[model samples]
Structure formats: C-alpha cells, structure tokens
Target: MRSVALDLGVHEISFCEVAGGAVVLRRTVRSLDSLEDLLGPSSSPARVAIEACREAWAVHDTLRNWGHDVLVVDTTRARQLGIGQHGRKNDRLDAEALAHAVERGGIPLAHVLSPHRRAIRHQLAVRRALVETRAQYVTTVRGILRACGHKLARCTTEGFLTVLSAAALPAETRQLVGPLVTALEMLTPQIALADAALEQLCTHEPVIVRLTTAPGVGLVIAAAFVSVVDEAKRFHHAHQLASYLGLVPSEDTSGGRNKQRLGAITKQGNAYLRVLLTQAAHTILRHKSGDDPLRQWANAIDERRGRHVAVVALARRLSGVLWAMWRDGTVYDAQSAAVASAKGLRLQAQSIEQQAQSMKEASVKARRRQRSIDKGLGATRATARSRPVSTSRRASMH
Candidate 1:
C-alpha cells in the first residue's frame, strides 16, 4: 500500500506519495478540487497522514469520505520525528517527513472528538470569551473612574450598570466611560444568553446531572468536565483521568533512586477544565461543612499544609472522585467520604500519640544516663580522697 503525507496550509497543500519505499509522486495543490483531480479515481486506497491542526479534522473527514484511510498525527509528535532537520523547513519538507513517519509506523494519533462533544466545547469556549471580555471592560471602567478620583463600588456584572449610574462622576469622565459601559451592557446580555443555553444543555445531560451531585460542582463545572472528557471509559482508572487532566504532580528521578518529590501540577491538559476544577475545589473548601467527608479531609489538609496546597490537592482529588463517579455510574457518596475521613483522622491521632510517647521515653533515658555518669565521677573522687591523706603522712614521717 502507498502512503500520502499532506502538509495543509490556509491557501495551499503540499503533499507527497510514497510507494514501495520510493517517492512516487510529489506535488502542491491549490485547492481541494485540485487535490481530488491530482489523485484521480483509484481502486486502491492510500494511507493519508495529516498532522492534527485546526483544519485537520475537516480534512480528515473529507479524505475519509473519499475512501482513503486517514491518520491524524499530533503536531508536537510529528515535529519530534526529525522533520526538516538539515535543510530549510518548508511545507514540502514537512509533507515528506510525515510521509516517512507514516511508512515507519508507530505514529502517535490524535483523538478526533465526536460532533456533539465538539459542539459543546465550542459553546463553552464562546461563553468563556464573552465573560472574559466583559471582565476586561469592567476593569477598564473601574480604572478610568479611579483615575478621575471617583471610585465606584465593586459590584456584580448584572449590578454594574446601577453602580455606575449612582456614582457621582464629572461630565467629562462620564463621557469617556460611557462607551465602555455600553459595551459591558451589550456583553452582559449575550453572556446571560450563553449561560442560559449552557444551562439547558446541562439539564439534558445525565452525566452533568450526576456530576452536580458532588460538592462544589455546579452546572458550569459539570458541563465543562463533561464537554472536555467526552467519555468516561477513555480512562481505565480515576488516577489516569486525573493524570490526563494534568492534576497530578510531576516526577524527577535518577538512576536507581526512587525519590518521589512532588512539584506543581504539569498543567498540560485543557486549561479551562483545570481552572473550573480548581474553582470548584476552592468553593468546596470555603463553603462546605465538616459533616461532609470530603470537606473534612480538605480541612485537615488545609490545617496541616497551607490553604494553597490544600486547594490544589483537593482539586486533584476532585478530579479523581468525579472520574470515579462517572465510571461507576454512581453519584457522590457523602456518607462513605465521611467514614473515610473519620478513619483517616483516627490514624493521624494515633501516629501523633505514638510520636509523643517515643519522645518522652527518649527524654527519660537521657536523664538516667546523665545520673549514672555523675555517680561514677563522685565515687571515684571519694576513693581518691580517702587514700590520699595516708600516702602524704607516710611521706612526711620518712
């Protein structure tokens, strides 16, 4: 079978065909129509390699429809395959590299998400952008007012207009800030609409509904998790899911040494999902009661470590817990969490008590050793004194 590597660009596509360990065809096509024309109708299907990019999925779908086997490789891994190492890097070189990689086999393939999951991801991304833009405008308004010596009170996005209206601002200042205020006003409604749409989407999703049962998880977080994860079965275990989300710590090991020093999270996966999980963890820690096992565990960690460490740990734990819930088709179990928390607390108490007892025994042993040394010195001095006077008297008589 032949292999075709395609380096896709906005305006053109550079491609190469390899058959029987030789470059059989190399060309540049200006459009999809031209590409089809060049390939022509053929009975034998060639393996097509496309690096995962913005247009990769669309291209993959098109090629698949054309009856060709498509392999979408991750861009990062494709680069690491020594593509364009010696000469000037260009589309042709990249295409050649991809072709050779395909022939070599073992190319890392990118997971193409389902259309439903992609739609949800798109909606979430749009909503996040709108919210961020609104926040930027809000900050700008606050800064402008502060500069003019008319500071407005901090208010929610919905209440910002009222706050701005009540603030006694100079006419010139108001004129300058009016446009930004209008922009914020426009953005607020759009954001609300997006939120409403997202809420409706979440309400229909059983996964999101089950996720929301966990403490600190609400509609937004649950939806975000569902959108990003797509499928719970992708992960074989809860820890694997956490690791995929980059919630786990990184490892640095050397020859024969099994030193596991935990550092900051890798933060390699979806940034938005990680942020939502962290926010949920923070909410749980701040507002949840001790009666809940997860809350109790978090509080214990917060007391031992600082709030920041506790929050990150809780976030990682939350990922694991959510994955477990999803995989098992079970809701959050507060009672079980509470029981585990109690058991952990008991073990901690016992460890502390054992440590204190060991310290006390060591202190007593040290005191006894000191007393024994002192007695030995005193006895030696008394013997010397008792024998010394007779020796001195005998010497004087002689």
Candidate 2:
C-alpha cells in the first residue's frame, strides 16, 4: 500500500507519495483539477494525509469522494512532528514529513464535522463577528463622548441611537463621533438579522430545544453547543465533553503525586463555545432562583469560593450536565439534579460515619492492648517480690 501527503496552499499543493520503503513520487500540483492525474487512478485508493487548515475539510471531502482515505491532521500536532528542524523548511520537506507520518501512524487526526454542523458553526462565527464589530463601534462612540466630558447613558442598542441623536453636544463633538454612531447604527440591524437567523435555525433543531431546557442556555448558547459538539456520541461521558470544551481543570503532577492545581481552563477546544457557556453560567447565577437545585449548587460554591470562581465552576458543570442530558436523550430536570445532590451528600455522610466508627474501634483496641501490657508488668513485679531475688542475686548479696 502507498500513502500520500499534501502540503496544501492557497494556489498550489505540494504532494509526496511513499511506496514500499522510499519516496516514489514528489511534485507540486497547481490546481485541484490536476489532483486526480497525480493520484494515478480512482480504483486504487491511497491513504492521504494533510495538515488541518481552513481548506482542510474541503480537500478532505474532495479526496474522500474520489475514494482516497483522507486523514486531516491537527495543525498544532503536525508542527511538532519535527519536519523543519534542520532549517531547510520548504513545501517538499513538509510534504515528505507528512507522508512519513501517515506511513508510521504518527499523525493525530482531526474530527471531520458534518456539512450541516459545519454550516451552523460558520453561521455562528459570522454572528460573533457582527456582534463584536457592533461592540467595538459602541465602545468607540463611548470613548469619544467621554473625551469631551460627556457620558452617554447606559441604554439598549436601539436606545443608543436615540441617546446619540438627542445628546446636547457641541457641533465639533457631534461631528467627531458622528461616523462612529453611524457605523454602530448600521451594525445594529445586521446583528439583529443574524440573531433572527440563528433563532430560526435553532427553532428547527430538536437537540437545541432539549439543550434550551437547561437554565441559562437560550437559543444562541444551545445552538452553539449543538453545532460545536456535532455528535454527542463522540464523548463517552460528560467529563470528556466538558474537557473538550476546555471547561475542566488542568493537571500537572510529578514524583508519584497526582495533584491537580486549580488554574484557568485548558482553553483547548472551541473558544466561542467556552465563551457562550461562561455567559450562560453568568445568566444562570444572576437570574435563576436560589431554590433551583442548579442555582443552589452554584450558590454553595459561591459561598465557599468567591463569585467569579463559582461562575466558572458553574460553567464547567453546565457543560457536563448539558452533555449528560443530550447523551441520555433526556430533558434537564431541576428535581433530578436536587436528588443527585442529595444522594451524593448521603453517600459522603455515610463514608464519614464509617471512617469515624473505624477510628473509634481502633482507639478502643489500643486502650485494651495497653491495659493488658500494664497488667502483665504488674504481675511480673508481684511474682518477683513474692519469690524474692534469684539464686545468683542472693549469693552475690551474701
């Protein structure tokens, strides 16, 4: 069997083919149309490996369609393969390294998202960009007003325009901030349209609907989770899902001691998903009633470790909880969460009680052993006094 590696570029692709024990083919192809010619034939499928990039999914899909086993390697992991360690870093070297990696099974493959999920992910990205642009414009407008000893009142997006229009400002200040306000006004409608489209998309997704049943998870957050996760079955447990979202604590241990130093999250996976979950956590903590089990759990954590820590913890827990709900095909239930909490508490209490009882029994045994030892010593002394000194001692005394 032969393996091929492609160093894909915007306008060109460098490929290397390995057969038996050496490089059989190494060349650069200018267009995707010529890729088939390089591959020889469609009947003889070859293992193809490529570093994951913006165009990776497209290339992978194309090659797969042509009967090639395409493996998209993670970009970061591919860089660590020591391809350019000697300074002669070029497309040919990279292609050869990738081909060798594929042959030796050293490449870490990336998850290939389905078309629908990829589309949703892209739409969410677009929405995030629009929202961020709008925020930037708003901040610029505020900064300009503040520089002139004026402060705009806190208001909604639509209200912001009204406030700008009615502000009693000098002509120069107005002119200076006019373009920013106009940009903001233009961004507002685009953001609203994106929100509306997201809402429509989420409305049609049953998984998103189930996710929304979780407190603090509205349409946007739910949709983001569904799109980012794609397949719930990918994670065997909630912990894995949470870890994938970079919500879990990082572990750093050595010298036979397994210590997990609580620090910032790993932030390894989709950053957008992490942000959405954190925002959802904030909403859950702020608006949810204390009586709610999830809220109570968060409140308990807040009491122990400040509010900010509680929010992050809640976010991490929320990721796991939502994943569990999705995996089990069940809706989030407040009562069930409460029951689980109570059961955990009961088990903890039982464990403490059993430990205390064992300690007490051990203490009693120690006391009995000490008493027996003391009694034996006293009996020995009595016998020694009653029988008098030994014959050798008596003779020495005489």
- lDDT by residue (tens digit), candidate 2, 246-337: 87777766567766456677888989889999998898889988787878888999999889888888888788777766776666666656
Deviation (Å) of 308 in candidate 2: 2.2
lDDT of each: 0.75, 0.75
* Model 1: ten consecutive residues of lowest lDDT: 341-350
- Runs in model 1 deviating more than 4 A are 38-43, 84-88, 255-258, 338-398
Which candidate tops lDDT?
2
What TM-score does candidate 1 get on C-alpha atoms? 0.78
Residue 30 local lDDT, model 1: 85
Prediction 2 global C-alpha lDDT:
0.75
Cα error, candidate 2, residue 54 (Å): 1.2
Model 1 per-residue lDDT tens digits across residues 1-398: 67889999888999898766678789898866678854545436778898888788788888878788889987656657667687668898889888887787888887787677677778899889988898888888898888888888878865787788988888999899889986775666566567656655655577776676678886678778888788887877667777778888887665767776768888877899999999988998888776877777888989998898888888887887777667766566665445533111111122455445534543453355345434434544554576546787889989
Model 2 poorest 10 in a row by lDDT = 341-350
